[model samples]
Target: MLQVEHLHKSFADFKAVAGADLTVRQGDLVAVIGPNGAGKTTLFNLITGHLTPDRGRILFKDVDVTGLPAHEICRKGIARSFQIANIFPRLSVFRNVQVSVLSQKKLSHTLFRPAQTLVVEETNRILDSVGLSDKKLDIAGSLSHGDKRVLEIAIALGNEPELLILDEPTAGMSPDETTTTMDLVKRLATEQGLTILFCEHDMDVVFNVATSIMVMQHGQTIIQGRPQEVRQNVTVQEAYLGGA
Candidate 1:
């Protein structure tokens, strides 16, 4: 569903992503794993239009979308969740999701209508999918960290994206919460048929859930293969395991 060809991005003298090429097929759960400064997030920024690539092409479906604006890319059916919780702190969970739903529909100007009443059913469905239905009326800032992350996922879901780009979805959660988040992501791909491309530091999470894994080091992909194949790769072992 997504194709990145010979992608390169640089900041000043430093190259962050160097000729990175990747393809994510429909309904595939692909994980990009790398250490700090490996350029995983930079690749994501390039694809999502947060940063223009110094070189290369980004194709979604079959159309080239190299330098499209973030919102335009999102409208083209790609949605991203940040490593941090990017929630509207003061907005109720329902309203937060409602805003996304409105944004997706280009109805942001419908301010006079009650957002809750306008998108209540769809918002509730998203909340249930993310296991946050009971917290629909709660303030976003007041939820626990794990719930906040789930809220971020819910917000991403609001766009009904064909491809979801998640940066560190299980970043700071406890063991149980991480497991729950992993389960949610698996269901997103398996049941909902959403294509997932994520960057994660948690090896166990990557190994357990990823259909394929790409290992990056020094701003380049060192290995791309199935979980077991990547696990046994010599360079991966030398760079990630030996270092760990």
Candidate 2:
């Protein structure tokens, strides 16, 4: 559960997030949708503490986390994936998730500890969850773009986050790959009850997978409603859906 009130962020003369307000309740798979330069990614950055807001407040699980560092946000049960893949290229797929697991346990300094095989089972389980069990031995850089995205999600899930924020989870995938990845996301939200807040440009993905939708424009929230409500909203249609 998260609540953001009148969040404002700016860079010199340009405002990236201007008085944006959002509330993500438990069990809500919320879609953040807007055109390019609508501050969607900037909003996520603000929420995750990658960029501190100039004003307003961010409350995660009823605790004010405004301006907390990125690591602190992750430790507090919020994990995120980026628009671009972020993974260890040379590490094996299994090792990628293992690194996150070790980091979660504060044991990243113990890398290459053959005597301490502590995260093997957890890493295997995480790889299996992401459908990468077969490729666990392969180098992460060798994976397809879609598998890489799945791996990123696995890494984010390594710490068992309560709220997962995905920024453009299907940015560069083939149609089939996009379906597979988004289906995986949907299953996590529906079957595993993982709360998700995703920013997506794909209208089909947004309408099909999200329970609720938030439309942003000019660095502000313009619409927040159920899927159907967002679909038919006149303002959203004029400002966002129409262009998309």
Which pairs, if any, clash in model 1? none
Tens digit of lDDT per residue, candidate 1, span 1-244?
A: 8888888898999999997878899988999998899999999988888999989999999999999999899999999999878999999988888789878876655465665466777888898998998989999999999989989999999998999999999899999999999999999998899999999998889999999898888778787889989888888898896733
Per-residue error (Å), model 2, residue 152: 0.6
Supply the global lDDT for candidate 1. Answer: 0.89
Q: How close is every model to the real structure, measured as TM-score?
A: 0.95, 0.95
Q: Lowest-scoring 10 consecutive residues by lDDT in candidate 1?
A: 108-117
Cα-based lDDT for every prediction: 0.89, 0.90
Give one digit per residue, the lDDT tens place, for model 2 in 1-244. 8998988989998998897888899989999998898898999999999999999999999999999999999999999999899999899999899889888877755567652476888888878877999999999999999999999999998877889999999999999999999999998888777899999999999999998899899999987889998888888998877733
Instruction: Give the 10-residue window scoring lowest on summed lDDT in candidate 2.
Output: 107-116
